[model samples]
Target: MLIRSFDVLPAIDILDGRAVRLSGGKREAPTLDGGDPLRLAGRYAAEGARRLHLVDLDGAFSGVPRPELVRDVAAAAGIPVQVGGGYRTLEAIEAALAAGAQRVMVGTAALSATFVRRAVERFGDALVVAVDVRDGRVAVDGWTHTSELGPGELARRCAELGVVRLLVTSAARDGSLAGPDLPLLREVLPAGLPVLAAGGIASLADLRAVRDAGCEGAIVGSALLAGRFTLAEALATATG
Candidate 1:
């Protein structure tokens, strides 16, 4: 099998029309605003980010994506952007794509086989499934609700439904900048699908560790926002 080089995705989480970061998936946790979404997206692109990861915090909690904001960011980003949060129905998915998102990500809805199958059939590879983990259990509803399914089981089901890539995130580690939960990543990688690891990536060494573990990509949020490392340094680690 040909190995895929790692990609470092910079995340932009929007809440009430501002970019913010949530610690340990807790909305009440210390939130750091990253300023205007379009400006931040443009800055990341200028720094050499080829792809961007965008999360609609309002949509995730309310179950409705801000299509206009998404459209604005995608248009200004000048790079491929994958959008996630509160995309549950076909119409919602279509709206995101029409808004200029290169790929639409579904979280809660992806737990259902029927939904995933229908989404894949309609969107093909343009759809990505996000499997958020908290304490070894799958989380939904913006990580406020824990489902009965485990990460491995969810990964297997997503693959069976024709999901070409899985965005696996550790809800407990998100924005913590401690380090990635490699064991959790190992569990989901058995399906042999392209997996992107998110949460607790504190430094370039953390990026190296994730790449060495065989992840196709890593999403760095608080680390970059915190100035722990520059995008250029992180991208070099990913490509190295």
Candidate 2:
């Protein structure tokens, strides 16, 4: 399948119903308002954003997803929403799907083999494993919990459980705007597993490097929101 397309997931980091950029992958830094999230999501939709990447800062931190808001965004926007944050239960996942989300992102729940297996079996490829990497190891729970499980091992296990998609993020480089750590991603490609690289993507060229490194897609948040690149520009250049 052609990985790169005229599609880029525009990110909207929702905290207290407003858009905020996490500094150093943190929730307690100066919260920035790119303004109302729903309005911004609509703008991106108008700009040809094929998908909306949304995170509930409160949910990611407190293990409580804002299903109402998730439903609101999905219902009001008329775009496919792929959400990640505190999705620990079947009910939460089902709620998201029922809310019109195209996919549900998995993170802390992956720590439990039973949960991972059940989720993959139940949801199939619609499940995305959110693998937060730090120094080539996996981090969990909003990047506050670090583990010795290497990326390749984690990737292998996730693929074994039938998860077709992986969302890989480098905690160290996140929101720094320096650049994505391609070297780190290259260090741990688990053969056939498809990965979407996230964190520290500063320019359109950064997205190209991600595709060249064999990632399925790249997620841009701060860079896109800050006008360094637009959704239309990024997606259009993803291939040519």
Candidate 3:
């Protein structure tokens, strides 16, 4: 089988129906609006974005995904959309996928072996593990709660449970535009699993760095929303 090269995924995080970015995944952190979620998602599609990373900040913090927004973005983006945040139940997972999300990302719920096994059995590769790392430990509940589990161990377990992909993010680097935590990627890749990196990507160099680190994809947020780099430029760096 042929391996896929790195892909650049544009992010649209929704909070109160507006697109926003949060620093360190902190709910209290000041957020910057990128504009309407639906409009931004459409723009990403028009700009040659191959995939979209859509997050429900409200759901991540509150444990309920905004299904309406997920449906709208999936409909408008005209591309594969992976939706995450507060997906803790099979019903919720099915709802998001039914709403047109090609994949549903789960975090806190992944800590449960029973839940993960059942989810994988039911959703298979459509279920993506959102591995948010904080201080080298797994952080859940919108990055507010740090788990005692190491990321690599969690990843290994998820892979063993049949999860084909992981969306890895460093809470410390998230929304900071400081650059991706290459070391975290190194830690998680030992499972020989495919991963999509998120957070702390500031420039083309950062994008290239993640790609070289063996990430299958990178989810870009604040930097692109801040106009630090164009989506086109980032895509070039990922693909080139």
lDDT (Cα, tens digit) per residue for candidate 3, span 123-233: 998999999999999998888889999999999998888888999999999999998999999889889889999989999999888888888989999998889999999
Instruction: Give one digit per residue, the lDDT tens place, for model 1 in 104-210.
Output: 88899988899999999999988989999997899999889999999999999998889988999999889888899999999999987899899999988899998
Report the lDDT tens digits of candidate 2 across residue range 139-212. 87877778888777777788777778888888888777889888767755654677788888889889888887
lDDT of each: 0.90, 0.81, 0.90
Looking at model 1, residue 136 earns an lDDT score of 87
For candidate 2, the TM-score is 0.94
Ranking by TM-score: 1, 3, 2
Q: Candidate 3: what lDDT?
A: 0.90
Model 1 Cα shift for residue 223 (angstroms): 0.6
RMSD of each: 1.0, 1.7, 1.3
lDDT of 2: 0.81
What is the lDDT ranking, best to worst? 1, 3, 2
How do all models score by TM-score?
0.98, 0.94, 0.97
Alpha carbon deviation, residue 18, candidate 1 (Å): 1.3
Question: What's model 1's overall lDDT?
Answer: 0.90
